[model samples]
Target: MEEAEDDLALLVWGQAEQRAAHGDPSFVRGLAAQLAGRHAAALEQARDYERQLAHVIRILALTPGRDSLTQLLRLLEDTPPAGTHPGLRTSFIASLLAEHQLVPDLVATVFDRREWEKLDELRACLFHELLLRGADTGTRGPLRDWTHVRPGWHPLAWLPAHRRDFEADARFPSRSVRGSASGVSSQLPATGRLDPPTPRPSQPSALRDVATVDVHETIVAAPQAGGWGACGAWVFLLDHALTPEQVPALLPTLPMACVAGLGPTDRFEVAARPMDEIWHLLFETASMGGSHTAGVHGAYGRLWAWRSMAGLSGAPADAGAAEVEQQARQSTWFHFEADAEWFHNDIGSDYGIAALSPDRRRIAVLAATDTD
Candidate 1:
């Protein structure tokens, strides 16, 4: 009974704070949670708050979807003290994390080591929460490996090639100075401008290599793309413009299918999870998994170490760290074919967490903006 009073007290205080300034969402959110816990007693207050929240939401509805998220973030920032409830602060910050598609500048604040450990998880957790609430990122493809079949020093050749159709939104182009933003063709949209689609490439390339790769969804990754462009680990950093020749000194050792192309602009997303999350994914996979495991291995070590070595420096790995990182990144090479419309949420997955516009039926590669 006493606990009920305490919870109600917290809710009242939170509700009061919410009224003072709709700016600090933390307080209101904290109150909402507290009220939810004391559902029977806090009925009146909860309804009042919900009505208020819904009302303000109407105002927010006026903004663009992504913009509304930004406004919420700004509202939180403007409130020096979001409120007394730590839960409230979590709720406010969480809104910003899930609502915005890819706010590079705002998210950069997450790296603030001093406050990072505390705020970092709120983002990941909330993303999943949003998913539970039916926030669909849109399916793109199956989570698996690509088999690379090629006779060359390039390691990426070992991975499988995505069928040209993998990019339904992309078109094949000859003499493309640079790949399109969607990475296949820029002049054409994904739906393929139907004037009797463009002719197949005259390059006479044998695409038999497309069969080697795959996906292993036995375990799961986060729902939305979080880091730079997905594949949100050091492999992302090593991506700073590697050459076809240089790809091997840093990539897989197996006989490759073929190396297509990788540039400096790639990205990925990963949790700042305890060193353990990395450890588990590295140490616990099935026997076929080259060097990655998932449970105890991750529990007892630091996962980022392997990425630093195998990724950035292109040096050989330490005793176990090297193998673990490599396998974790590469193990999912098993093929699980599906349509882009079904896997848009997992697009750029080879790289990291990305939210592809499943409805984006067209694509156009932007002209080179960086001459360097």
Candidate 2:
């Protein structure tokens, strides 16, 4: 039986490779379509195998000398804009870019045009991959073009100028904190004002350098695990619906939080942190479990012990600290440092939280307002 199973796997892999080469969309779409419903472990194993095949195809296609970057970019732009198999093609292009270390050019081009589109997040993830791989590489040349585009307001426009600030926030510590073997029940630090304002990062001079009086600066929320970490098990509250074009603006606000829409996660236990956040947001939408009104009575039910609400405000004095804590757990305010866009292109609606149910429908969001 073991031998039979191994033979079956090889047979399937061969067919997939054939389909991938023919620019068939079904094979890739099928994998992406299965992403949300399956158990986490199984899904990850499948993606790893798929990535291996993708890399093999990319390496084989590279020409000896003529600008490989140009070839890769043409491959990306050539993908069908709207279709069932678009992801497969786009992901194929993304994999090629990542494999060849073309991130700097990718980022520079995106901002140079301020071209926000359906795959902006994928590009952001690519930029993130570049960030992780190119830590030692200098930013002067790669990002120089990006700075001249918007100077301010464009997300990461200040990246060239504020390279250090971007670097400091993006770097997550590797030290692990004590938690469940699953890493699910780890206790996160309480969300409260950090005493002594997080020192403001040096602003770029407008005259001598590109600077926006509107530059946003805030201390990153305490590291999830403290050494170097990404956003985990946290809730985001938004006032309105988001669109694809708005994603880059929103991403900078979440400089520390890594989500499925932004990029992949390095953690072994999770496929991508954003997926978990989306699932919980979906669960919240379905259960309406996280919504609450102002005051003590609204703090009903047990909150997830591990997660912290960041922007919740306005509690009555008589409500005991425990009650306020409970309230926060339910409808804590989330403070976004900047405006946002729809996280991913697949999202269906803006009415409530932008997530899909187990069946892939739009999920609900907390109705509590800024004052609540």
Best by TM-score: 2
lDDT of 1 by residue, 181-245 (tens): 21211011133111211231223222121111111111111111011121211122221433322
CA lDDT scores, all candidates in order = 0.27, 0.30
RMSD to the true structure for each prediction, in A, is: 22.0, 21.7
Q: Which residues of candidate 1, in runs, are more than 4 Å off?
A: 1-41, 47-325, 329-372
Candidate 2 off by > 4 Å:
1-68, 79-81, 84-96, 99-128, 132-139, 150-372
Candidate 2 lDDT, 1-372, residue by residue in tens: 122445545645666577778898686455444443344767677677666544533543233233555454444455423333212344334433544444545555533343343344345334333443343324565344333433354332222233222123221112111211111112111342121122322232121111122110011111211111122222233444544333223322232222223222211111112323322332222212212211100001002111212111222334443453344333312212211222211122111122211222111111111111
Worst 10 residues of 1 by lDDT: 362-371
Q: Tell me each candidate's TM-score.
A: 0.22, 0.26
Compared with the true structure, model 1 gives a TM-score of 0.22
